[model samples]
Target: MKGSQLGEENGRRSYESLRRTAQALETRADIARAALRLFRTRGWAGTTVRDVAREAGVSVPTVYSTYGNKQGLARALADAADLTAGVPRQLAELEAAAADPPRQLAAMAGYDRRLFERAGDVLRLLREAGRIEPELAAVYDDGRVRADETRARVFSSWPDGTLRPGLDLRAATDVYAALCTVDVYTTLTAERGWSPGRVERWWSDALARELLDR
Candidate 1:
């Protein structure tokens, strides 16, 4: 009977620990969703700890306890958002989609379109943070370089590749990313107010001529 009771106690302890962990994760998720909503609407400076606490349906002290401070809260919120977005999985999808150029570039275009459509919200959050939080940006998450390498491999072996002589796969891929970086889109569309059609035409021509065409 004593052994039975002890076993029961251990089982209960395990269940309790699991329950606590699940609750903590749920709370953090709530905080993250609330932060994004608030950040999108109120910008950075206008949003407060109290605002998150209210939206998250938690106490002000609880917010402090969970995230430590405003910046810490923002960092946690971003981390949580990344997790919810399944960005790592999306990145894997990106690599898999790279088998075809028109398709790979299209996949990239889809991702960038979603990113740009939410530019106001994203820019506001970034502006609030000023610089990327060091902890959030890690060397292990260098998927961009890996993706670039993959593109280089795919492009360098092209039948027409020899025409570019010393350009090489890696260099060509690097140039591809440089040309398609968000700054280019922001510059042409947001800064100069170029028509989307015009921008697309120019981009398509540039890619076909410089990369695809012999």
Candidate 2:
């Protein structure tokens, strides 16, 4: 009888610990979301950890303890965004159309268009904020490297004899990366007022003409 009672108490303690951990994670997510919102609307220079805490409905100390600092919270937001995952999934889907290089290029452009349409604002905010924040700058640089690598992988996977004559793999990859950057997306969609569909079609046609044989 005593053993059964003790087992129940231990189980209850374990359950409580799990509950507490889950609650902590929830709080952290709340704080990150709040910080991202403030960063987007207020800009990085204007947003503060205290503002995030107030927006998240948690105490300032909790925000600090969970994320360590503003930079830490920003990093957490970047991770949560997982900007790296979308490209690979899109590329993988392009495998089925690999036999037709033009079609594959079009698919890639479609992917970029969708990605920017969904996250362009957040990405622009991060890029602008990185100018002032050293830590965020590093994160932005890392993201660029990852994006470049993805572009390289896609170029490498192209069927032989498909690339335009005289364009080396490195040069071609560089051109593709440059053409499909967040800056270009922002300029076309936000600055020039081009529609998302128009931008996607242009990218598809442009990339195909630049990278593939006539």
lDDT of 1 by residue, 50-79 (tens): 999999999988888888777666565454
Q: Considering summed lDDT, which 10 consecutive residues are worst modelled in model 2?
A: 79-88
Give candidate 2's TM-score.
0.68
For 91-157, candidate 2 gives per-residue lDDT tens digits of 6667877677778778778777876777666677677878887888887778678767766777788
Error of 1 at 194 (Å): 5.2
Off by over 4 Å in 2: 1-32, 48-68, 80-92
Residue pairs clashing in model 1 are none
Cα-based RMSD of candidate 1: 7.1
lDDT of model number 2: 0.79
Deviation of model 2 at 173, angstroms = 1.7
Judge candidate 2 at residue 153 and give its lDDT: 74
